[model samples]
Target: MRLRLSALATRPWLVALLIGLAAQALFAFHLDRPGGIMFDEVHYVPAAKALIELSGPRNIEHPLLGKELIALGMDLLGDNPFGWRLVPSLAGTATVLGVFTFLMVLMRGRMRVAVTGAALAMLNQSLFVQARTAMLDIFLGAFLLWGLVFLLWAMRGTRGQVLWRWCVGAALLGLATAVKWAAAPYIALVALAFVAIRLRDARRAHRPLAAALLSGDQPHWPGLPSLAGLALLGAISISVYFATFTPTFFYLTGATDGLSGLLHLQREMYAAQVQVLPHHNYQSDWWSWPLILRPIWFFYAWDHGAQRGVLLIGNPVIMWGGLVAVLVAYAVSFRGRALRPLALALLWTFSVAIYAIIPKSLGFYYYYHLSAIFLCLVLPVTFDHFDRTRDRGWEEWYVALALVCFGYFYPILSAAPLDGPMAFAHWTWFPGWR
Candidate 1:
């Protein structure tokens, strides 16, 4: 009865929207805390400031769209900690809304579980920490999630709406890639998903693979407009990508020789990203991230009477528990051949691919940020299944556990100064974390 009431919110969309705003509020509220640049803020905040002052290229390894967005925030909010980080915090909140909307769209009539997923995303330690800082990853990730949602919506649209939705999705991704090339893989994954969905639909309808390729299958997937739609989507995506570089195009003209300057600049950025580097203090392999075994220390402070440390890491409750949930889902999902399970598997696989393939040596702990959110998304599936089947306990317990951890870790994550050395030491449960 309580479960049904929970689902009976008068307008679930509004509830999700409010949750998004609340999430944003939570991230935005502490902008001025533990004052000064933290972590990658040292790099991005300066670049953002440079863009505002029209200073020359800085943080040249990445494109300037993200910095430009940050500059806009600084322009309005003032050039302090709050101002530099303002847009990233808001983008993080908007990401929560996007995730909620996507889950609602993905799972028909399953508002409760969708909300559960978004809420988990809100609290995941790594995601929450990443969102709070002035970093490119959060901005890149927020737009990627939104674009994927819109792309899925396009797949569900009529011919008339399909083109428009697809174009919009492409445009968002174009901007996302401009923020950080890390989003390039997401764009590729979506194109790949379009083909996979069409193929899967044809096979489900018992059409011969060869014949379908030759002439297309009967009763096409409601989720997919057509195979030719793939071509159209790709073309629009490329055009949108080029469109995002307009600022870069002109910015380059001033900073370099000509159109050749643009090409040369891109090559330099690419070279920097792939260049090998020696071990650093915060560098941790992707394998350790899932276990919460390694974390980046963003800042440490000692005042006349206060001491505080800002550690970048995941919440053990979600990281460890979510890992178990995914293993359970993987084992059970294949046994039934269900669409929900299959979709879950594909989405999980994509996020994993993004992290797993990254070089283990140069990997920063934050590289695992998206994977942590993916696990959070996967973490709830097992619990949602239990609720639907009257096989319960996991959902309630998991939520309880997550809430407890959220408060327990709030001090360090928010950059609150510690009461004493002992208090700070207590938060580090593992030697590697210290």
Candidate 2:
């Protein structure tokens, strides 16, 4: 057993591939369940159909890429439950793989840490429910995560390959924003991080910033192009964002003409998105999201002589335990001056911080999905912090505990038949959840 574990740990790419395939299978299983549109599918799926028919845009408050993907899926798969949800399920699988790759790179191919983090990502309930639904978050999340992955790759790539890697990263970031405006802050963060790193390197090297930009010889951070070059990379993302609106140009009546029309559409979307709305039964404050204080019920129904529902709640084992893991990881990183773990912790913070400053009047638990993923990364570092004694046996047991919790909650997360009509009551552990 020890030999097998050791061998697998040495093959991080294989572990990531296996994890990705398993996630894809799990997400694809029984994806047509509940027999109809459950929650937000009521909004986006129809817009997709509308897009396919050159009908008017129905859900114009958001960008077009997510709906476009849904339309593409339906176009290929014949417009049923399978078609509507295929893209999200695939996106979800990509998210799990992205999480694994991010950890592998960040931790320098620490396979155990990457595997543990990726396992936690699968066990995190929010991803499962969101993946099965036709919502936009998972799509945006996959792009954002892979975008970060490429950014990390750019940092370490050979000089010949760095510029293209950086451009690919920037373009993916733009695709994320094209899916949802929520990705705007992350794009800004990427650009700002590039500028900050270049400026810092210039100061340390005692060279003028312009000289550094022109030389394109960033020591310790090779391959990153000049500031003007990066701005053009940023334009790549903006152009990608603009290109997704091409389908909107074909709309029967409200066809967007060009750059001016796209700008008009964006203003209209901003107004629609920011306008205050009535209270929601499952609406939650940004602070309560990490606590799992309230979870949105994507679907709850009695069908085929059985009762079942899908709840967008995080696995308590991870949600509650991750809070402690983050704090411990923080203390350990700060004490040891570990920059990598600190970076993971900060990424988690910024993911949540986007919500705290957004102009939207109401928020829901699903908004916490991105931050919950970061917790997966943070939890593994916490384990590494304590594994100084070289006993990795505990990590396996921890993953086992998470797996048990996932099994216990599987019926609720996946819309599987429940034991009785009040089965949902058993899963709702708090008043807010009710």
Candidate 3:
């Protein structure tokens, strides 16, 4: 029994499975409650149903993959609340597993760090809210994380396996872009990072740079992809993104039957997305996102004879503490103390920085979802750093505090029954939150 238990404990797949199941259960619980469309469901759910009937178009500013998946759920389960939300819940669960896989690879198979990161990701308030609602960000997040996961896997794969791994990573990222254009920056980041690393490796190995570029060899990390491989990966991603639009060609109202139509649709999407719009009450700046300056209230009303609300906010402990963790990680990296944490910090920064360059004039707190999820990586890395420095209890205390905050905010985060009409006051610690 002891040996069997030990074996079970060491199996990362089993552990990841458990984590994914727990996340799904949480996202699915009371998912059918509120008994009606909440927030953007009014946009995507109808859009999804319309796609199924091929009657008209809706929500044209975004890509089709997310709505297609939502439509699949509704078609299979009946066009009800459960059907509308089930896919996003599953995507949220996939995001948890992606976090686990990503950290596992980044940390060199340290199960503890991976599991801790996944747990924090599962508890992130934004993830919880987006997972329960029919939204595109969670889909974007799941694909984005898995894309990075595959890229990390490519770094460690054998020579014959690396190319295929890169392709898979690029494909997933392409799917992410198909879900939303926000994912496009990540692809650029990946391509640029690969080019830089490949060039660095060639210089270090004393190889002729031009020769190495054509041959696709790396001295430091053997099997690292070459420029040619990167191009192929980009092509694969673009193909995937284009393929997602195939269904749109058949849509009765917004059909795009050829390449010219596809180009026209792209122009329409760009016009709709970037056009300046009236300010939203919950609109926030990118800089203030990590600070949790504002949160979007997806739902607030009397349900089952009590007040309930759903607030798209990050867990305070994780958000605030993760910010500190990123700073500390950067400091340590500058002093030559660590390299991996530094990479996480850079990725976290880039995720938020993409929003700054995008042409969109309006932003919401929920746009910070990617940044909040990346904090899961920073948190575990910080815990590992503390453990190495003889600060053994920080991880435990961090997890405990995170769980406590999650419970305190559970009522608002999950649209659970509140104490009274003013129950929101309990969680609204700051005036801005109101």
Candidate 4:
């Protein structure tokens, strides 16, 4: 009985992932041709067009890869509304896949947890809205999540497997950095963590420093060879990122300057973002995000002879539940048994939270808190404990409750054209959410 249950639990999460991806794709299709650019798409589309023309200045605020990807869709689709949004829609779907894969790996192939995470992420308002628009957020998120997946794989694998993991991780990090520089620090954080883990294990095992010097020979370190491989991977990723901008930098601008231009651009962009303090209706603080205090309205319209719009907000059920679950995970993880899950929860939580305190005046609800989508996964792990200790039927009850909550609020979240009273009812859940 135990063997059968274990086998069932270990089934691959690919089916759930496909279902989630398909759902997002269907949602994207619904939004295939929004009449006009939604909020940030205004900035992104023109920037992308300029990029395609090779006439636009290099934007230090974001990497070129996402714009480049958008340009591809524009070229193929003739630069219409559908064309502009196609890439983000696809990228968003791909993020669902990446999240599913990450959860599967983290949960040791537990289908239940993996499916729950992917489904919740797919349905997340911020993730869904970003995916349906022509913006860099989904692109940045995709690459970052992919890199994280690779990092998790590397942590679990042996020396021979570590090289491949590092290589893939490097490539993903490069792609992520090319979409948004915000993802760059995570690569360094993971690398430092990896090095620390290996060093500690080496000391624990009492391995001689000389033995550890050998490549891929040490049991824990993967030794010097692994480090060399990681270095090579880093170089390759960085080379790819720089190579993409080389032609334009050298030919168009006659700028033979290396690295200085990138640094200068970053400084300018940072200054531009930090100095702006004009009050806005949708502005929210980092402290309020975990509480789902205020969600940014990405799109709204009432003039099409009827009310219709998309309001991007985190799923209230999942956001609140996951927030609590993360606290529980932290407590349980300190006991050692839940260490891995606790580490991932902390990583996901801290990565976004630290950025929230950056003191940049223009920080928006969407900028840093997007990482919270992953927190939903932590709740399912918490549910697993409930399944073990509580009633065996608790899993079904929990899932049903979550689905019910999602369905109840679906109209407001998806802009399904609720009337004044209906909308007012939804807004009453959190007065500030309005």
Q: Highest lDDT among the candidates is held by which one? A: 3
Q: Residue 27 of model 2: what lDDT?
A: 90
Question: Which stretches in model 4 have alpha-carbon errors above 4 Å?
Answer: 1-17, 58-60, 158-160, 208-215, 218-226, 250-264, 303-305, 356-359, 385-396, 420-425
Candidate 4 has an lDDT of 0.68
When 2 and 4 are scored with lDDT, the better candidate is 2
Candidate 3 residues 150-244, lDDT tens each? Answer: 98788777788787888899899999999999999899888887777777777877877785567645652355547666787789999999999
Model 3: runs farther than 4 Å from truth?
1-9, 219-225, 389-391
lDDT of 1 by residue, 158-186 (tens): 65666677778877887788888778888
RMSD of each: 2.8, 1.8, 2.2, 3.5
Clashing pairs in 3: none
Q: Global CA lDDT of candidate 3, please? A: 0.86
Worst 10 residues of 2 by lDDT: 220-229
- lDDT, residue 36, candidate 1: 80
Worst ten in a row by lDDT for model 3:
1-10
Backbone clashes counted, model 3: 0
lDDT of 2 at 405: 93
lDDT of 4 at 64: 70
Q: After superposition, how far is residue 396 of candidate 3 from its true place, in Å?
A: 1.7
lDDT, candidate 4, 219-244, per-residue tens: 54353354675586579678766665
Q: Candidate 2 on 88-145: residue-level lDDT in tens?
A: 9999999999988988887777777778888888888899988998889999999999
**Which portions of model 2 miss their true places by more than 4 Å?**
9-11, 203-214
Query: What value of lDDT does candidate 2 attain over all alpha carbons?
Result: 0.85
